[model samples]
Target: MKFATQLIHGGPAVDPEYGSLCHPLYHSSTFAQQSMDHFGRFDYARSGNPTREALEEAIASLEGGSTGLAFASGMAAISSTFLLFSPGDHLVVCEDVYGGTFRALSTLFARWGLTVTFVDATDISAIGAAILPHTKAIYLETPSNPLIKITDLRQAAALAKRHGLLTIVDNTFMTPYLQRPLELGCDIVLHSGTKFLNGHSDVVCGFAVTADPEVGKRLQFIQNAFGAVLGPQDSWLVLRGLKTLKVRMEQSQSAAGQIVQWLESQQCVTKVYYPGLPSHPGFQVHREQASGAGAVLSFELESYILTKRLLEGVKLCAFAVSLGGVESILSYPARMSHASMPAEEREARGIKDTLVRLSVGLEDPADLMADLDRVLNG
Candidate 1:
């Protein structure tokens, strides 16, 4: 089957027991013992649930991986994946990473002795230079958060292999629909299903998928031990959201392209960041890897005063923290997403105070432009 078909029929779609179109939601805390000789495939809800298993299997298939594990939230998946490494192990990570991931590494993981070296991953050589003798893996985020920076996945994965290091990519921005890191020689792929994967913004979930069985086994153990598995209801919701992934992404991206063109034409906008733009730093590299530029873009104003006016004056788009919902969301990264980082560090990463990130929704391009135009000119 093709990619679009895979999204709907990727995993357990129909109820095997009743032939219902939707997968049945199994809410039991524990399963009954059929025989005393051995436990069934599902012994307890914490270890497994039919509904949750369906969602996990779907993500694994969508990501082209051998195994998939679900978690309560994006941070849970990230934290549990970090458990795969031991104390004293080193990792090389992208510089403009998600703040929650940064907090986990700089605070909790660092406290446990898991050292990390942050680099501008857009320059693949910077990542290579940061690799220490004990470096176990290289983590990356392409078309990175708020800033919309892109990292070349194939080159980064090859570099990791030469050093006998694992390549773990956070595939949240592109989703499996647009980019599959496992196909590019990466060992594992992670996602915050709260974003585009869930699409509706109602569910908070995460996934860890890997094509390697050994890595899959370790992550499965960590997920069960941590007991932060996504609940059955949220699992079903994500499953429902998966069916419409292609259409939603296409429409939102179309609107985003128009908005990018408008933002560039505006006199007040100082700079814009988007992979689809020809002038974008990694435009060609992104084209070679992912199928789309995605619906998110970032732009900077001449001053913080203009930034505040644009953010507070916007009518249609909600000035919010999260992205990837059907509704347009305008975010201030310096104060919203990257607030955890120190001032100097955020500035060094180029997450400026005047930067504004936008996640284009399914609204008409002209309507969104008018809303933004009214806000900017008013």
Candidate 2:
């Protein structure tokens, strides 16, 4: 089946017991067994739920993975996935990864003895140079958060394979509909399902998917042990949201292209970072690996004054922290996503005071342009 069809029919879509079109929510914290001699597939909520199971199946199928694990939030998914490594092991991660991930690794994981080296993943040489004898994995976020820097996933995965390291990618910015990293030789695919997968912004969720059964089993163990699983109702909501993935992504990507063009022409704008633009550093590499440029883009203003004005003055786009909702969201990395990082470190990673990231939504491109113009020109 094609992507659109798979969105609707993939996984355990039909209610096997009730014959309902949508998967029914199984809210019980524990399941009953017919006999003590034989345990059922699910004994406790922490281990699994029928509702969450359906959503997990959908994500795994969408990403072409053998297994999927759902979590309460994106951070939970990421932190738990990192648990797959031992304390003495090291990891090479994209320097511009999402702030929450950076914080977790630099503070929590580091304290636990999981060392990491941050590198500019856009340069394959940088990734290779960072590898050490203790390195166990390479974590990446392509069209990386706030900066929109793209990494060549296939090349990176190949390099990891040579070093016998796991290749894990955060596929939040480019949902499986746009880019399937597992197919590009990545060992694991991760997502902040709160973003595009749940598109409506009503639920907070995350997923870890893997094509290798062994990796899947390891993640499943961590998920169960950590107990950060998504609740049944949120799983149902995300399942409902998955049906419209194709249409929502198409509309948002179209709007983003229009907005990128307008931002490039604005006098107050100093630079725009979007894979869709030909001038973007990873334009060709991104095009070769992914089906679309995705809906998020970041731009730099002429000054911090202009940046503050535009972020505070946008009338149509919400000045908010989260993105990938039905409404456009404008966020400041220095104060929002990357605020946890030290000033010098964030600057070194190119997340500047004048940089603003935008998640274009389902709104009409013309209205969005007019609203942005009013804010920037006013």
What are the per-model C-alpha RMSD values against the true structure? Answer: 1.0, 0.8
Cα lDDT, model 1, residue 171: 91
| TM-score per model over all chains | 0.98, 0.99
Which portions of model 2 show Cα errors greater than 4 Å?
none
Q: Top lDDT: which candidate number?
A: 2
Deviation of model 1 at 2, angstroms:
1.6
**Backbone clash total, candidate 2:** 0
- Each candidate's lDDT (Cα)? 0.92, 0.94
lDDT of 2: 0.94
lDDT tens digits by residue: candidate 2, 184-303? 999999999999999998999999999899989989999998999999999999999999999999999999999999999998899999999999899999999999999999999999
TM-score between candidate 1 and the true structure = 0.98
